[model samples]
Target chain A: MYVYNDFDETFVRTRVAQFRGQVERRIDGSLTEDEFKPLRLMNGLYLQLHAYMLRVAVPYGTLNPAQMRQLAMIADRWDKGYGHFTTRQNIQYNWPKLGDVPDMLEALADVGMHAIQTSGNTIRNVTADHFAGAAADEIEDPRAIAELLRQWSTDHPEFQFLPRKFKIAVTGAAADRAVTRAHDIGLVVVRNDAGEVGYQVIVGGGLGRTPMVGKVLRDFVSKADLLPYVEAIVSVYNLLGRRDNKYKARIKITLHENGIETIRDLVEDRFNAIRAGFGGYDQTLLAEIEKSFAPPAFVTKATDGYEAARLANPAFRSWTDTNLSAHKAAGYAIVSISIKKHGATPGDATSDQMRVMAELADRYGHGELRISHEQNVILPHVHQSDLPAVYAALRKADLATANIGLASDIIACPGMDYCALATARSIPIAQQIATRFDELKIEHDVGPLKIKISGCINACGHHHVGHIGILGLDRAGVENYQITLGGDGSEMTTIGERAGPGFSADDIVPAIERLVTGYLDLRRDPSETFLQTYRRLGLAPFKTLLYPSEDKADAA
Target chain B: MPPRFTPKVVTANALLDGDAVWLTEDDHWSPLMSRAELITDEAHADLRLLQAKARASEIAGAYLADARLGADGPEPVHFREAFRTRGPSNYPHGKQVETPPQT
Candidate 1:
């Protein structure tokens, strides 16, 4: 993990001090709500439907054991004994009191974390693949670039307040685990024909009311020129992005209005103008950041014990099969602790759960942790030999529900339950669907399905990119849900298309069940996953199944 | 023809704690929905909204919520306001967790 230096520490402390004074002024009748709203948002404080929410950035989804423990302490001390990990690899405290937020910020700063740029119309936290350093197919750890972007954009005067909130994601692997294509800017680390590693820059991709797959602005840009290149992109957006309408303000809309070629030309011109200003400073910084991400040493370990445990315990076997991923290091595995336990709040972890994860990271994962964009915690480098021990510890904590990439591994936003912007509730729908699927005992059989739900078109839960997407809406004070099929957020990113009319909240789960059961019969074989089958056979079959005619409905 | 006026209440999140509170007949914030001042006149609703907004130091994002007097007290007519009254259904937190049963 990247440790904060003197400058970083001082910078965070200064921000906290500034926030403390701002809080005091607001409470003492010096600052009005209007005056304090933007200030509070800049520091990651949000007044939601019920309470104040404080979002803390987990840079590139990476954390050390100490930082994780502090997060647990903060949850227990200030929040309601739990925190919600978001799809952006950030942790949110939904119940922090406004008066106690300054203290929370201070505590976060103590452990080399801060809530800066976690909200507002500023460059937000730069996210990377959760399996960055540990993935077997990685070109390079993308966190080096992610950290550079974080430092450059934290309080960058040039891009402090853009036309809209901008998001950036980087992935080192060929398989896109970071949902790179759904971000405002997506950087895929790819090697050029010359066999030199560089970024395949995709610009204008975003998921909100309007969903778009990013256009390839530049096929490849060398690592040395990455910062200046990105700065140029943001600069172009800052100039050309619409200011007249808040809904049409994002760079995606800008890119849509003015073609990618024109935007590319402007970006190149701006790149040349400010490219000299970077002065090779970021290259030097990148080298230092790369050193901090050096892989831990691996020792030869026996796997017989792991095999024995798998044979002895069926639950452990099932968990390992679903939750373990291939690691770059020999005899090591990337363990995904499914925070999305069946039928509960997705991405919610209690203080005790957080502590157990911190301890497991310390004992078996080299004191390191990574939060996936899927809302699960990752022990990035666990030795295969220690799988039994990790599994046992996790089971004791109720953290061992093994539903990664399955039907029950659902991604849901806070929805109307907590969000002021939500039109319909999303959490209960997700819980009911997961619980219903578990009761059917068909989750494992369904296999490799991503069910993502968003409260509204904001797409915070990434509903637009799920294989089975459920979008919650409000129609005449009643909850209505719309389903979409064939969306894939992988190397081949495609927005899922809506399947006809919406389903009421009550009828949604059964409707989903019908869709999935119909899909099982629609597939060529069980080997073909949901996405594979949907891609192979178009939405015609699924559409008919979802909204079957009176004749077809009676036949069933 | 003019649109009929609906009963309303001035609601806002308390600045210090960020919990939902409503303006009362006595010009104070009460966390309970039943204690909220029910406004049937449009002019009075606007006046109460302005009065609630004036207390900026004590509250944030004050606005009129659509509600009506039920058999008990002020009950939310819209689902959004109903959620605010009882809190989120996913968990027993906020007003639902700490508040006593409705009279």
Candidate 2:
């Protein structure tokens, strides 16, 4: 994790003071609601359905134990006893008091964190792969670029008020864990034919109402020119992006209106003009940032204990099979602590659970933790020999669920339950599905499934990329759910195709159960996953199961 | 025949606590839906909304929301408003923490 310098500390302290004064002004009738709305949003405070929600950014999904413990303290003291980890790899306190938000910001800054740039129509938090430096397949650590982008975009004079909110993600691995293809600006590190490491910059990919994959504007941008290159793209967008309509203001819409080639030409022209302005300071800064991410020293440890423990305990073996990922170090493993316990709200963690995770990080994970975009906690450097002990600690806290990629591990946004923008409730739907699936004990049989639910078309749940996507909507003043099939968020990414009419809230869960059970019958075997089967056979079969009346009429 | 506007309540989140509150008949903000004044007439509803909006120090986003007087009191006609009166479905918190779950 990158420690804050005196300059960064001063910068955050100043923002806290500014926001505290702004809050006081609003209280004294000096700043009207209209005037304070943008200011509050700039600090990541949003008035939701029940209370004010505060979103805190965990930069690049990296946090030390002290920061994690401070987050727990904030949750317990200022807000509710728990916080919701979002798909953006950040945490949201759903019941924060408006007056206490300034104090909350001060507490966050005390731990070298802040809520600035977490919201508003500006460059949002820069996300990276949770297993960035620890992954075996990574070309290089992507956090260096992610941090550079974070510093450059934060309070940038020209890009602060973009046409719409911009999102950027970077992934260093061969596998697409960061969902880079779905970001407004996705950076995939690539090694060229000449053995040069550079970024394959993809633009215009987004997942709101209009879901579209990004186009590759550049095949490879060297590290030296990356900052200038990205700035040029944003600059071109700042000039050409639509501001007349909020819905049509994203860069994706810009790319849709003007062809990719023309936009690429504009960006390249701008890049040439402004490349010298960077003055080569970004490269030196990047080198300094890279030094902060040096891998921990490897300690030689025998794996006989791990093998014996796994063989002795079936539950431990199952959890290891489900939640463990390949680590770059021989004796180390990446442990994804499943925050989505069965039938619970997907990403919520109580303050006690937060403290437990912090302790686990300090004891077993070299005092480091990562938050996955899927809303799970990641101990990026857990040793293989310590897996049994970690599993025991997690189980005691009800955080040890052996479901990572299964149907029970669902992604859901805080829908109508908390968000003001949501049209229907998403958490209940996710909870019902997970609970129903767990009761049947066939999730492991279903195997490698992704069910993502979004409350509305905002796609905060990343439903656009789920194998089975459930979108909640308001139909005739009642909650309705629409199903989509064949969406994948990996390198072979595609937007899901909608299956016909929507189902009522009461009918949606059962409808999903039927679809999955039907999938069990239609699959070649348990070995073939949901996406593969959906690809082999089109939506015709699943559609039949989801809307049986339509299939019945066709049969008649 | 002209369509009748449904009964309504002026509702907003409290500026300090951010909890949902409704304007009462006595010009005070009440956290309980039962205490809310249901404005039946359109003109009166607009006036009440304006009055609520003027209380900037007390509220953040004031607007008229659809409601109807039921056997008990003002009942939310839409699910979203009902959810606002209660709390999130996943947890027993907010106003509904004390009130029994509605069937």
Candidate 3:
């Protein structure tokens, strides 16, 4: 909910105007596709397989009611009647016309949002935990730091032409919902032994064709030194990162080739050189940004009505049990409205659905909303007394799926369906899996599973971190899916290991069903989740479940 | 011995709308793959692709895709090209919106 100031507003308007001229020039044949391609990508426009895709950044995954409503309006007026909320907490309009994109961007700027830095080699949108301000275990709200980074990274001259696209994530809480370890740079707000609040700086983690858990660059850097410290890291990466091959261009490969100690030494040298120049200016800006994120006033309310509703409605109870999270404020709950309804495309919300969520946020959620990296809409500060009302509105809108961490709640990329880079269709696979699981009615019983799918090895879907990861590939001109097990994107980040041969598109759903249903029997108890069980037993059991024919041969 | 030439068609996303379009026998960009000029010869396929790429103002990322001759027109031989011919399976958008019968 960081409101744009005069400078921010003017900057966005200037960029939009610039892009409009560029689009016109491209159409008029003044600028060739080669010249215009990079310019359009910088503005977050890409010509995909079927249409132009515009990725609009939702900075820190935060939106006010007005901004949410404007997004709905934009979706309805232009392109399709819905938008896909990506794993990066940004929204993508898949079918935008090239001529109308300028207008769409202008509309976005009207609500202090833009698609700037959502694509290309420039620093992408800085993401944070969706439950930043509201989580019970949070030490501090990470949005202020995230906002500071956003301002610093947006159009930063020196870092714009880095070797590869860089991603940064910050999390305030002890829990790692932001997938901090899988980003190029991850900052966890922590208190040192001296009781000074600072950040645990992690560098070089990424999850594309080559996945790596970030290395700890610094134990702690005081809040005042964060800007210079991060700048030093990027400055080091900018010079030393691989440029010869695009595949080896990310900072991860740099760290891998040069080792973290060497990178750390260089970063420290750079940090020392630049530390004095900062002059606490970034701290002053952070203080100003913090003012916009002040928590809303909480009202003490009776929970008798909430308790009564729970008793009266089993569906409401079920939803509250799964979709609600513990809020920092007393008598408040963080409501995660599942956008992944059974058989529907994951992360897609229609204009009507968006409006419904906006209205509900206004009525019961303090006019604030959040888009989770898991692709769900969150009402961050709903009072327990208003839970019933929120639930009712969500149910009416078909947003009450009551499946947040269950088997059916899958994360899937646009895949070959829309992406030019995709080798196989991911959305259809996600849909079939969810629909099949729903039909079996074992999602809740299967318990706390994260199934993530990516179209290719780019790992935009974060398939590397799912408990059950499905990667779609083109094996001899046919769609093939490879399954991986034991991946966890938590405090203990682990990359999933592939389980033998791939499954055909027709065989994949049943294959997944066998693996998940097999968990019910393999687990010590229902209390032990999928990740815990997989850890305890290893891939041997799950591998057997995934490839039963091999298990039968072994038995024979 | 050279590999057998696969039948192919020139395809690209339209510059204005970004919808998938194929170069027809008349050298016009048609949204329908059926109207595309199928090239059986490898040299002709490469030449047609180059011609399509030259029309940069009208299209972007023009390339040749594998296809086969059908009763009405050319049919996509690969699933990727087949998806491009209609639209995404998730929704009735894109070419599916234009031609509802196929959807």
Candidate 4:
């Protein structure tokens, strides 16, 4: 909900003009494909399988009503009338033309948005918990720092071109909704014993060909030293990161090659040198940024009425039970609008639905929306008094799905349908799974389960972190799927281990059903969740159901 | 027989006015003979037609000649060269080049 200042406005406008010139040069042959590739990537323009795709950044997944309306307008005017919200909290238009990308950038700039660094080997969008400011258990609002990092990293000359793309995530809540541990750099804001706020900085964690949990470089870095510390870390990676091969170019690989102790010492040495030069500039900037993100004043209203309404309407009660989270303010709750409608594509919202969300955010909640890392929208602050009205509006828009963390609320990437690099279809697989689970009426019985699917090894779907992860691949011109179990994408993050042999695309869904049924039967109590049972028993029991012959031989 | 490579034509969304067209053959883009003449088919008839057009003597001559223009002016010169050369401001055939009067 932060408005662009004159400086911000001028910067984006100038960037758009520069890119337009670059595009013109590319079209006229002044720039070759090799030269133009990096330039286009810097602007978030990608040449996918069939057409060009443009990805626009929604910083820290926060958007005002006006911004959401602008996105709707862009989708209708420029794209195929629908925008795909990504797991990274960005929106991608899959069918943009190459020549019109400059115009698209200009349109975004007009709305105080840009696609800069949304792609390419630079520091990408800084993500945070969707319910950052509104979460009741948050030690501090993560977006304040996230926004500061956004400004500092934007067009940073020194780190603009890295060996590979970098991602950073921050979370202030203990529950770790931001998936902090799975990022190139993760920062968890924590208050120490003296009530002084600092960040617990974690480094070297990422999901891709290699998956490793970030190691803690600093247990506590003071609030003022955050920017300098980050700069030092990035500088170390920039200088020492592998450039010989694209596959091993990430900071994770660098950390792996060089011991963590060595990297930590180098980062600390760099931080000490830069910390003195920072001289409270970040503190002043944070104060100004915090003013823009200040929580709205809430009236002390009676929530007994809301309780009565919930008791009267069973549907409302179910929705409130599943979708609502405790708010920091009394008599308020943070609501997550589920986009996972059964049998529909995941992470896609029609323009009309977007407008409806924009209207609701402006009228009922604080005129703000946050797109979650799970591809859902969060109306961060809504008063208890207005729950009934908001619920009714959402129902009218068909945005009132009661499933939040249930089986049907799956996170999937735009796989073979849109991505050129994808090996098989992910959206249809997620859709079929959701539909099958809905038909079975066993979703609620399955309890909290995260089913993440990636079309390839890119791990864009965060498949490595799902409780039941499905990875799509191509085998001898036929589509095959691999399943992994015991994954967790939370404060306690762990990469799932692959189970037995890969299943053919036809055999995947049945295999998943078999595993779920196995969990149901093997569980000591119905209270045991899928992940709990998987972790307690390991992959052996699930493998028995999935690969019965292999299990028997192993048992022998 | 393998399909031939033909340029695919595309129009700017802003300039299309819902009447523009392009030809795509073998991943290459080229200007169509006429926006109205170009048509889509359920069975990839347009792609076949584009491949045939790329092999036509007249189209091949124009494509080679356009390459001589050296990255400026009309691209993949064909009947649509007039539009690309003169700009859509002077559509339906006009002088290819004109200089403004000295200020």
Candidate 5:
């Protein structure tokens, strides 16, 4: 993890003090609510449905044990006893008071974290693959570039108030774990014909009211020129992106209105005009940042204990099968501790759970933890020989759920429960589905399905990219859910297609059950996943499963 | 034809705590939605909302939410308003901590 230098430390503390003054002004009526709204949003404070929510950025989803412990302290002191890890790989406190936010931010700054740029129209926290450094297939750690972007974008004067909120994601592996194509700008580290590593810049991809897969703006931008090239794209977007309507303000719409070719030419022109001024400073900063992310020394430990534990304990074996990922180092594995326990709210971690995770990170994970965009905690450097001990500790804390890519490992936004913009409650729906599938004892059978739920069209849950997407909406003043099928957020990104009409909140779980159970019958074999089956058979069979009555009528 | 106005309550999030609060008949903000003054007339509802909005230091995002005059007090007519009255569905926090949801 990147430790804050004196400049970074002072910068964050100054902002916290400034925000404290602003809070006081707002309370004393010196600043009107309208005036303070934008300021509060800039600091990642928002008055939601029932309470104020504070979103703190975990830059590139990286955290040390100290930072994680501080987050637990903030949750226990200023807000509720738990925090909601969002799909953006940030944590949100759902019950923060208006007066307590400054204090919460102060605590965050003490640990080299902040709520800055987590909200508002500025470039939000730059997300990267959760397993960036540890993944076996990775060419290079993406978080180094991500941290560089975080430094560049934080309060960048030229791009602070863009047409709308912009998001960027980076991934080093070919697997695209960060959902790269679903962001405003996506960077994939690739090797060129000359075997030189550079970024494949993707532009204009976004999910929301209008979901679009990003187009390749440039095939390869060298490490020396990545900053200038990214700046050129954002600068072009700053001028040309639509601001007349909030719905159409994103660069995706801009790319749609003006052709990508035109945008590409403009970006190239801007890149050339400003490329000289960069003068290799970014590369120097990147080189410095890369030093902090160097992989930990691997211990040459015996794996006999790990193999024995797996043989002795079926539960531990199942967990290892699902929650562990291949690590770059031979003796190590990336452990994804599922925050999504059966029937629990997805992405919520109690203060105690946070502390336990911090302790685990300290003891077993080289003092490193990662918050995946899928809303799970990653012990990114756990050795296989220590897996049994880690699993034992996790089990004691109820963190050892063996459901990483299963139906129950859902990604859900805090719908009407906490969000002011939500149309319906997403938490209960996610809970019910996970609980139902767990009760049926078929989550493992369902296998490798991504069920993402968003309370509204904003797609905060990335429902647009789920294998089975559930979008909650208010239809005639009642909660209704719409289903989308065959969406995949991977190297081959595809936007989900909506099935016909909506289902009532009561019917949605059964509808999903019918669809998944139906999928079991339709798949060619066990190896054929939900997404593959949906792709092969298309929407007709799934539509029938979702609306059995319509199928019956058609047959009749 | 003009649509009939629904009975409404002036509701907003309290400025300090940021929890849902409603304007009572005594003009004091109460966290309990049951104590809210339900305005049957559209003109009165609009006026109450305007007055609620004016208390900038006390509240934020004040608006008229649909409600009904129940036997005991005002009850939220929409699910969203009902959720505001009692906290989130997933946890028994917020108003639910003080007074558990009645069925």
Candidate 6:
């Protein structure tokens, strides 16, 4: 894991002190709610339905054992003994008193972390592939670039108060685990024909009321010009993006209104102008940041033992098959620990579980842990020989769930339980569906299906991109859910369409069961996943199952 | 009704206790008053005092929107707003009393 430098340490400490002063002023009645609200939001404090929620950024989803331990401590002391890891790889505490927020921020700063820019209309925490350095298919580590962007974007005087929040993601591998395409700016690290490293720049991608797959602005931007190029893009958007309406404020809407080609030309024009000003600074900064992220030296080890253990234990084999990925280094594998336990709340980890993860990261995974966009934790560089020990520790902590990309491994937001904006409960719906699927032992049979839930149209859970998306809404004060099929969150991204009529909170699970059973019945074989089948036959069959009465009524 | 501005009783945090209290009509702040004393009775002296305090506190203050009175009762004002109108601990509302000179 990368250690914080003096500059990084100083920045976070100063921010914490500033926030503490603000909080004291608010308490002393020198600041009004309207005056204090933006300041608190800038530090990622939200006034939710039941209590004040504080979101802490896990930068690039990377944390050292000490940082993880500190998170556990924060959960135990300030929060409700648990933390919810969001899809953006941030951890949110549902309950925290307004007075205690300064203390909470101070505690975070002690561990080189803060909640600054975690919320508000500034550049958000830069996300990257959780398996960045370790993934076999990666051209280079994306976190190095992500970290550079983080340093550049944090409180950048120009971009601080944009029309709306901006999100950026980077991916080093072809698999796109970071969901790069669903961000305001997506950078896919690639090597050109001459073997020089650069980024395939994509712009205008986002998810909300309007979801868009980012359009490629540049085929490749040289590694040296990354920051200046990004600045240019953001600068253009900041100046031109809609301010009249909050709904149409995102860069995507701006790009839509003023054609992508025009935006691209403008970005290029700006990039050309500023490229000279950033001359040697970007290279020097990138080099400095890269030094911080250099991978640890690994001794060659045999994976024969790992294969032997897998053969001996079918459960281990199943887990290895689904939860493990090929590592860049031989004899090492990237292990993804699924936070989505069958019937438990998704993306939540208890204090004990967090401590165990910290311990496991220290023992078997180079003391580095990563929180993935899919709402799971990754032991990035675990030696194959140490797999058993790590798995055993995880099992003890109730963190060893084999379902990683299966149907039961669902991504859901906090929903009405915590969010005042939410219309219905998403967590419970996801829990019931996961539990039902587990009971049926049909998750594996269903194959890799992404079932994402969002409480409302905000799309915090990214329901728009799920293979089987469920959106929770309130109809006359009753919780109702709407289903969408044939969605995907990948290079081939497509927004899912509404299946049919909405189902009551009670009827939701049954409706889902009906849809899944329908998929199972209609599938050519078990090899055909829900998404594959849905894509092959379109949404007709699934829609038929969801709205059978409607079909019958139409027929009659 | 063209968005009638009701006679609202606003409260603010006490410098010592951080409790919401009704601002009394005699330019004095009363500590720990009930929601009924803050609102509902337009003719009540306590409610009138609260209203006066609320107006004065508007210089630089935050209203706690989430804090509301119980059902079938008068609306409660925030505690923070009260303290802003009246000064801090070193300065008390009654002790630092300045009677306006007759014009």
The DockQ-based order of candidates, best leading, equals 3, 1, 5, 2, 6, 4
Candidate 2 residues lying further than 4 Å off, grouped into runs, are B98-103
What are the Cα lDDT values of the candidates? 0.92, 0.92, 0.93, 0.80, 0.94, 0.81
Per-residue C-alpha lDDT of model 3 across residues A1-556, encoded as one tens digit per residue: 6889999999999999999999999999899899999999999999898999999999999998899989999898887889999999999999888999999999999999999999899899999999999999999999999999999999999988999999999999889999999999999999999888999999989999999999899989999999999999999999999899999999999999999999999999999999999998898899999998999998899999999999999999999989999999999999999999999999999999999999999999998999999999999999999999899889999999999999888999999999999989899999999999989999888879999999999988889899999999999999999998889888799999998899999999999999988999999988999899999999898988888788789799
Q: After superposition, how far is residue A388 of candidate 3 from its true place, in Å?
A: 0.3
Off by over 4 Å in 5: B100-103
Candidate 2, residues A159-264, lDDT tens digits: the string is 8899999999999986889998898899999998899999999999999989999889999999899999999999999989999998899999999999999999
The TM-scores, chain A only, for the candidates as listed are: 0.98, 0.99, 0.99, 0.97, 0.99, 0.98
Q: Tell me each candidate's TM-score.
A: 0.98, 0.98, 0.98, 0.85, 0.99, 0.87
* Candidate 4 - chain A - TM: 0.97
The residue ranges of model 1 lying beyond 4 angstroms of the native Cα positions read: A549-556, B100-103
Query: Worst 10-residue stretch by lDDT in candidate 5 chain A?
Result: A545-554
Tell me the tens digit of each residue's lDDT in model 5 across B16-95: 98889989988989888888898999888888888899999999999999999888799999999999988999998988
Q: All models, DockQ values?
A: 0.87, 0.83, 0.88, 0.03, 0.86, 0.05
Give the i-RMS of model 4 in Å: 14.8
- Per-residue lDDT of model 6, residues A110-132, tens digit only: 88898999999999999999998
- Pairs with steric clashes in candidate 2: none
For model 3, state the Cα shift of residue A5 in Å: 0.8
Location of the lowest summed lDDT over 10 successive residues in candidate 3 chain A: A545-554
Which residue window of length 10 is worst by lDDT in model 2 chain A?
A291-300
Candidate 1 chain A, which ten residues in sequence have the lowest lDDT sum? A545-554
Question: What is the alpha-carbon lDDT for the whole of candidate 2?
Answer: 0.92
- Residue A290 lDDT in model 2? 86
Cα error, residue A478 of model 3, in Å, equals 0.5
Task: Give the per-residue lDDT digits (tens) of candidate 1, residues A412-513.
Answer: 999999999999999999999999998999989989999999999998989989999999998898889999988888889999999889999889999999
1 against 6, candidate with superior DockQ: 1
